[model samples]
Target chain A: MDIKEYKKYAENRSKRTSSLKNCVLAFIGGGIICVIGQVLFNLYSIFTIEEHAKLLTSASLIFLAGLFTGIGWFDVLAKIFGGGTLVPITGFANAIAAAAIDNKKEGFIAGVGAKMFIIAGSVIVYGVSFSILYGVAYYFYLLLI
Target chain B: MKNIIKFPEPVSIIQSASVVGKLEHEGPLGQYFDMYEDDIYFGKDSWEKAESEMCRRTLSTLLAKANMKYIDLDLVLAGDLLNQCIASSFGLLDCNAPFLGLYGACSTFAEGVIIGSNLCSTHQIDRCAALASSHFCSSERQFRFPIEYGGQRTPTSQNTVTGCGAFLLECTGYPPYITECVIGRIVDSGIKDQNNMGAAMAPATVDTLMRYFNDSGKSANDFDIISTGDLGKEGYEIACELLYKNRLDMWGKYTDCGMLMYDYKKQDVNSGASGCGCSAAIAASYFIDKLKNGCKDILLIGTGALLSPVSVLQKQNIPAVAHLIHISNSRN
Candidate 1:
């Protein structure tokens, strides 16, 4: 079809497109993303990793997933799974991955490295800000105790 | 828990204007933006930049009309449709408002209002502003892709509104006092159609409304009107059906911003509803018009689908989000 005809039909095509293939793929992709978490849960049974350490592993896995997403691989996976790749914690990993990768392509100092941490850095700042507030509140609670 | 958050002084909204639908002479180019050298939303210019500029310009005109000193104002609490709020950051650079950038997709306007109202109520700043802006071209490119990239659109897909809307969320001790935030609910109906975002997001609207109704100890009938952000026609009907199916009654004076703007027949407004800007523009412009002319209490429900085109293309069903803010002009 010509471009104009394509534009007219595109809307209809999007609706008619089958979700079955995508849905199955998404389920599989999403399941794959969570497979690591499932393994870590099993490892928790085998070896007594501290709860915090276990949590760190989960976070790290998500971060690693995000790192893959940044490289553009995860997005492709996300596309196939629809919400499967996206609905999980792995989606966030993809966002960070995409940002860092985009920035890196520009060059590290200003482009890649500087830009990589923009959103993540803010999240850290906000995290610290709230943490300090909680710490102060805890100190007051201790004084009352 | 009581916490003190400092903010800049409050400033009145001296003036405001919104551009909606297609412009007369602009041709395919919907609106003029000073931020873009080319002013084309579909080109290589970052969509994040395009949307931000839309918001900045809208706010600038409003501020300029009010003749308020930007330096005198306390802070700008603003949000956008971008995932991490890249548009808002770039948007504020032009307006130069000290900003606390926020993200809630379509809900950003109400989120801005709630925060601004809280700061204003605390008398932290004599006057403060909360604003949310969205643009279709830029949003599509960032989250979906360039419009020209020409992927298929669904009949369920509403054309993304092209303009920006800004609200002056002031704590002018403006009589109504914004005493409470009856938070909107987030419901996700497992509908995977990205084209009919309104239908997918309707469940979130219903869930949030139900929660708000329960929390506020109020019924849907309590408010003068309960308006939704987008949801167009199909979503609106779906929402009604879903509400009825759940045995919840929300039958009166409810409307959607998508349905309100543009004539589908005349303008060929293909999809039933669309993006974050649809609600932002409606709330800031249309609703504000009503409020200025003494409209009473209202519940504005803003909805957003968190899914991107990339995710959809990969066959991901959309997950929806919504937030509700109850605005009242009543005095004690």
Candidate 2:
């Protein structure tokens, strides 16, 4: 058989990710994380304003993710949670922290400092560029209105 | 043209030893391994060093089993999955014999056997050692991601085996002899997904197996068992289907080291186990034990995907190779 035909056949035979199972698990996992965030927000709100509570809640989740990653628990959690842990702020923190820990052997400046953003670099770049583009577009619409 | 190399004289595998980690120790063939370490680090500070240490201890165990020392060996051929093959160099540092480092990815162990057997058969060397190793933690950080990275593994992805296997080959000494070998050609199957190594490597397995059958005029029925190293479940099926299409059927007799290394249903490993150590450890322990028993002949085809992280990032298609070795109980 030719390469093209074999490629097509192999693709058909290979195992695929179970989208339905992943979706259900992600819903439950993400829901649990959000519920934790909500509880944190309420506890913080008892001591401060709503804005401060919201900021503190996000900070708390990021810290927890980083701590879990450092302690080697985040990957195990992510394995079962799938996208539940990935689509949250915790995932972003885990990404950076994992990279930093992995590259730590190469020393600080070239290793941890440079490669810390390796995974999240693209996300940051596209996010900032699109936000700037949206800001300029909205400013023009506001002036015309 | 035919690619099979028939040895003029049989090279005997006098002794073989395997060292595996906790997960592998819990596998089906766990009892066959010579040594098992519950600690992934093997008392080392870093993962890279742990891999080197595994290789060092494997060679020592093989030498001990053979009742020989490193100085008694004429040559040592070793390889691993680490960049620059550092594991082999650093691990075998205490060896007092001449050494050659090979880089065949997962197929490195078979590649070493082929070379070592050829040298022994030709009388260029009296005794030679072939060793290969891979640590899951080390290979993961180098090839895919950090162990602590919070990312979901695809169903096609394989878990790298944390183990090492060493073999001692001599011109005359044992029953399980290396009779024939076929050095594989690089075959590009146009597979680009890094996660799907089985698909990338299956075509190479087909190419090598077809060439072996055509060159030797031997069918799948000639061997008691034909095993491929580190192809996992996906590649194993594809190889079987492709070979059947080419008029060579290996349905029942064929199996894979990757598939045999882990229990897919019980273990969290997505497809199965992989890496240089997967084939090496299995070949040295389980298959060698079979040869020692009543098993007549077997064929071990080591399949490997020759793609680096840089090559994958650059969008280069994975090029794979499969090296074949025919090991038999009788010298003839």
Candidate 3:
């Protein structure tokens, strides 16, 4: 069909699209996601053990985020924010916590230990898997050196 | 010949444009950021700020497109996933449109449409508009946890779309007919796995889709397209399998908002999707594209998981629901 014809038809079908309310909910939900991130950053800054401890702070943030994911607070945020909560460092935490929590009910060894690795393990595996592939390039650099 | 009732006036496109913004992953915002961002640590706050900025930009584009003044619109109807509807409210501030805040989880889009259609249909407000926006950040913090608290996520978990979508519906002298009322049904499966939301909400999606088919007395083949919200790969597969098993073969085209919004190849996202806005945004952008292309009869199914983390932690199973909206171009 011609451009004009297509445009006309498109407008007719467009009504089915979600109205403004849904978008607003999502936007607010997105904002809520950021608020949590800010709070975490603030807490990390306040609990500084040493000067210029960026690595330590980052690690703690990751751990705390995961811990909250386990306790169910992060999940609640996920529900409220929708995509907002799931897209950040908090999501990583949620993944780890979910694995650990999911395993906790089964038992510490196979359940807890095995389940805890459900998501984190995958991250590590993927990380290692890709690093190995890319690490080959590093080996070449070492050989050249 | 079907005696279809047509609203004397049509809805006009006073103006329309989509805006976008970026965010950092941290706390509340991270929830949304996590949905779509592959490598980033921005959180809900960043999502919120970005979302607000997007709305402002979209509103500006709408005004520019329509070549009208901000004060021209009689009313602005909006909604979001946050507690007080901050992003919509804040972003609309730039648009200068009068506001009406609403919530329907993922169904907010329809809510806006119904209300906007009514306002224009009744001629109660001339030149009124409706807008909707969803961001990744703000949603995470309020519904889940703060970044400072930190947490772990499940593989079944869906990452929020690190993006926002908006729509502008205007009332015109020649408005699109508000044909049939396709209300959503709340179906609960009592399954608590957030990761398996598609499974949890599958029943609802199927139930609603079939019911709408029965109510309309129309077969699945009658519609040109069928769409669902947030049912990603698992939910989508389950929906088709169950529908096929029940002998309710959906012959029409079908798609999910979660699967289409982002390119998985570039992102490598596991399982298709999440986020209430997934359906909303898809319905706005993609659906419009389809409609404009001449495909008429359409079915829109929006699925939502009513299971909260607190409820799950409290030992409650998850419950999911789906709402079906029917759309067509048979208004004459």
Please name the candidate that would achieve the greatest TM-score relative to the true structure: 2
Candidate 2 local accuracy as lDDT? 0.92
Docking verdict class for candidate 1: incorrect
Ranking by lDDT: 2, 1, 3
Candidate 2: residue pairs that collide: none
User: Which CAPRI tier for candidate 2?
Assistant: medium
Interface residue Cα RMSD of candidate 2 after superposition: 1.1
Q: Candidate 1: TM-score? A: 0.61
lDDT of 3 by residue, B147-266 (tens): 333333443445565444444555443322334445556766555555566666677777777666665566867777788877767667767777886678875477777666555565
Candidate 2 per-residue lDDT over residues B1-332, each given as its tens digit: 65989999999999999999999999998999999999988998888999999999999999999888888999999999899999999999988789999999999999999999999999999999999999999999999887899888888889999999988999875688999999999999988888889989998998899899988888888888899999888788778777888889886899999999998878888878899999999999999999878789999998889999999999998999999999999877
Which of 1 and 2 is the better model by TM-score? 2
List where candidate 1 sits over 4 angstroms from the true fold.
Answer: A1-145, B1-48, B175-179, B309-317
Residue B133 C-alpha lDDT in model 1 = 69
lDDT of 2 by residue, A1-145 (tens): 6778767776777777789999999999999999999999999999999999999999999999999999999999999998999999999999999999988888899999999998988999999999999999999999999
lDDT to native, each model:
0.63, 0.92, 0.58
Cα-based TM-score, every candidate: 0.61, 0.97, 0.60
Task: In angstroms, give how far residue A127 of model 3 lies from its true place.
Answer: 31
